[model samples]
Target: MVLGTSFHFDGQGTATAADAMKRYCGLLGEQEMEGKSSPQWLATKELVKDDGEMVFEEGISRFCPNCAKILKSAVEGTYPRLI
Candidate 1:
């Protein structure tokens, strides 16, 4: 399977899901939270429990820091024995 920084984006260098979220968040304005977790974290949890890889494939080939963090959590969560 493909690996590393190269898998981070498409030929046009766009991360559709993350980009869309950026725009969407911009329109929505800043959300002030003292300690609330990000929406991405919530979604990542669900994804890891479900079909996280497929979701990951559709977006950037590269894992953003958040994605990478959540993915590592998911992988470890899914396969404790391996860890």
Candidate 2:
């Protein structure tokens, strides 16, 4: 049940999963090289009422005006979330 994915930098300027984990842990002030662990890294599995379906409601998914504009531009192929 992975909630999300992250990116990290390898020695060659590329992001890897292990590097991402280290960066994430470092953000929390936990020693990355000391073999320390954080509960936040653990994954939790849960059941949702709808299986493989998107539930949308009016005004429930509102975003900031600026963000919405940016997203719209992305949708139009003018902007990209990752560059």
**Best-matching candidate per TM-score:** 1
Clashes of each: 4, 1
Tens digits of per-residue lDDT for model 1, 1-83? 22212322223453445553333233222232123233333244334433335544443234343344444444445422220
Highest-scoring model, lDDT: 1
- Model 2 bad stretches (over 4 Å): 1-61, 80-83
